[model samples]
Target: MGETFYIKNMVCNRCIASVLDIFGKEDYTVESVELGKVSATAGKKTNKSALASKLKEIGFELIDNETETLVEQIKVKLISKIKSGETEHLFQSLAEEFGKTETALSKLFSKSEGMTLEKYTINLKIEKVKEYIQLGQLNFSEIAYSLNYKNSSHLARQFKTSTGMSMTEYKNLKSWNRKTLDKIV
Candidate 1:
């Protein structure tokens, strides 16, 4: 049997690809790496700590235990909330399901990542909104409503606050930057 290590900020498939690439370079056959755990055998010629160091250098850190798992779960849920409106039940509103209060989650998240849960959630939402805008499938008003925003103007205001650019301007940019963010495990 191999070992499993949880990871933070691993919210997308690209993140998984990047992690596997690193392990492959070191001759480690990664068995599996989901949002919650990385299953891998101790390679004959690889140092797990050294591999960790390399991951850290590239902004990937190995995680362990329940607290870490819960945190990542929260982040993934928040990301999905923004992306596909998948949270029919808990849309940036994990308070009722998690047993603990959002205040407590926010405290733990802030201590771990130096940013509040709300801030992280909002940033992710903005990123997804940018994605929607770039794809040009949904209009600004529709996008705002889909994202659970009160109104198009409110969404525009919040977006401007975070990104310093209006939706109109961001969508109009000839050279736009599409973010290939982390995956949902």
Candidate 2:
């Protein structure tokens, strides 16, 4: 049997590849590597803490508890959905997707991550909006529609609240300031 380790900040394909490379360099036999979890057969002398330290050096962290692991899994799924260019859904749908009750998941997420899932999703959407704006391919209304916001003004209000700048101000700035998916929280 192999041990499964949950990792924070492994939210993309590049992250998956990077983690596999780290396991390879350390001579660990990785049975599977997914967005935020890795299953590996442990060697006789494997050092979990040392491997964890190595992961931290590259902006990842090992999750030890079920609550923390679940929190990271929720984050990974939410981030993936936001980046997939798909339609948005209610929190109930998210709960159904994870096979958990919405109330339980909401409490766990708020307790473990210090933010409600709704706030986290909003932050993720705001980050995506910044990316769209940076590309300069869409106006505010278009960006709003693409992101499933009710209207351009609604998106602008959320963006301003999150970034302390209006969409126009963000566009007129000398440089773009954007955060990556893993760094959003």
Candidate 3:
């Protein structure tokens, strides 16, 4: 009932669905599930050692290192917060949940993922901004504010840096490239 297992690349909502689907079909009643772990129900035990084999058979991998596990948890939480429009509320909440300085989280995130956490976060914000632009419901200032940017110019600066073009240029580019999420799991 208390067994827990770690999964590699459990970085997004789809990854969450993937893990739950596996347990559902296998008829294993899961006690709980989170970014990097699944707790097994006592009478419904499934071997943790075998999860690696089974998970990979379905495309997820199990990560064993302690540091990678922590990094992935942070990444998943950050990604979800960004996706759900909760960016401004996350910093204090996350510092408490992880029991570490945001500086510490940023350093570990950069060390593990080969990019600054701010860069990763801005990439996601840009993606969402682009979505709003495409939807035609929000103008630049509104989009910037919704994403917690200091101002439209700041959002424009970040958008340009990440995609090598201004948000206006990106939308008007002869060819538009949709952004992809990082493989943070």
Candidate 4:
């Protein structure tokens, strides 16, 4: 069986692709690559230390502690849910998904991340909103709907609160600055 490695700071499809590339270059037989985890068999020529170093060079960390691994899993699950726009009962669903009580999960996340999960979720939503605005394909209402906001005005309020600028002002900027998914915190 291939060994499974839990990774930190792998929060998007590009991160998965980057991990796959690193494994491929290192001659590992990659079975699968997903957000925050990989299953792979090391080839005879593969250097584990080198592989870890390369991942680190690109802002990914190989997580060894069990608690840290679980925290990374929580981050991956929450990011997946947000990307899918599953906003209803987010906390309750996350607890159920992990087979833990909401309070337990909240405490664990808070202890490890040094921020409340709700704040993290809000940060994610704001980043996603920035992406939508940059794309210029969707209007405010459409973006709000896709992100499961009550309406454009609600999204606008949250956006202004988070970003310190109106969406129109953001859209009018000469350059848009959006944070990478893994760097949300």
Candidate 5:
């Protein structure tokens, strides 16, 4: 049977590609790679220690412990939902999606990650807003609605609070202040 590994800091498509390349370079036969998981078969010559070190060098982590694996799973699920414009029913659907009660998942996430899941979700949303603003393809209202914000004002407040700059100021800045999706946490 192939082994499945949970990965940390795998919050975007680029992260997936990076992980696949890392495995490929090491000549591991990757069965599948997804948001925060990779299934692979290690040959007899495979060196797991070197693999872990390489992954860490590029800001990705291979999670083998149970608690960390669960935490990564939660993060992947939340990020996927947010990016897919499914923020409308996040709280109601999370428990069912993760096969645990909301309270249980919340407690576990908080204890392991040292932050509330709500806080993490907001950070994810704010990062997406930054991306949209940087793209210059949509206005604040469209971004707000797409990200399920109640209104532009609310989005503005959160964006300012998170990044210490208003959205307009952020968009007008000479240098970009956006963080990679994996770095949000």
Candidate 6:
């Protein structure tokens, strides 16, 4: 049976590919790799210390604590939700998905992450907004609608609060700054 290793800061498909490459280089038999987790059989040639160091060098962490693993899982799920535009009843949905009460999950997230879950979600949403703006495909109203904001003005307010600039100002910038999903915090 393959062992599962929880990872920190794996936020996208590229991260999965990077993990797969690392495992291959380490000569492990990888069963599967996904956001925040990998299932693999360690071969004789596999040096776990080297693997962990490689991951760390590339801005990832091998999560050994059960609580830290759970927190990373929560982060991965939240990122997926934001990407899929499922922003309604977030706490309730997450609670049901994790089979835990909202309060319990919130407390756990805050304790592990040093930020409230709500703040994390907002940061994710703001990053998504920056992406859409950079793409120049959607108007402000459309972007707001896609992200499930009540209205464009509400999105505008939140965007300003999060980014320290209005959407128009961001668009007019010579260089657009965007955060990688894993670096949202």
What residue pairs clash in candidate 4, if any at all?
Answer: none
- After the best TM-score superposition of candidate 4, give how far the Cα of residue 168 lies from its true spot, in angstroms: 1.8
Error of 2 at 146 (Å): 1.7
lDDT by residue for model 6 (84-106), tens: 98988988999999899999998
After superposition on all C-alphas, the RMSD of every candidate to the true structure, in Å, is 3.6, 1.6, 2.9, 1.5, 1.5, 1.0
Top of the candidates by lDDT? 6
lDDT by residue for model 3 (7-51), tens = 766766777788888766555677888876887653455555565
Q: In what order do the candidates fall by TM-score, top score first?
A: 6, 5, 4, 2, 3, 1
Instruction: Estimate candidate 1's RMSD in Å.
Output: 3.6
Residue pairs clashing in model 2 are none
Model 1, 53: alpha-carbon shift in Å? 2.6
Provide the lDDT at 39 for model 3.
Answer: 77
Model 3, residue pairs in steric clash: 1-42, 9-185
lDDT of 1: 0.75
Off by over 4 Å in 3: 25-27, 42-50, 57-59, 89-92, 173-176
lDDT of each: 0.75, 0.87, 0.76, 0.90, 0.88, 0.92
User: For residues 1-185, what per-residue lDDT tens digits would candidate 1 score against the true structure?
Assistant: 87776777676777788888888877687888765457887778988788888888877787666777778777766775566675444533686657777678878788877788777767777878888888899999999888777789998999999878888999999577655545312
Candidate 5 residue-wise lDDT at 45: 73
Candidate 3 lDDT for residue 18: 89
Across residues 1-185, which tens digit of lDDT does each residue of candidate 4 receive? 88998999998888899999999999999898889999999898998899999999999999999888988898898889888888878889989988999889888888989998888888988998898888889999999998888889999999999999999999999499998878876
Q: Local error of candidate 3 at 126, Å?
A: 1.7
Off by over 4 Å in 6: none
Instruction: Quote model 5's TM-score.
Output: 0.92
Error of 5 at 185 (Å): 2.1
Off by over 4 Å in 2: none
TM-score, cand. 2 vs. native: 0.91
Best by TM-score: 6
TM-score of 1: 0.77
RMSD of 6: 1.0
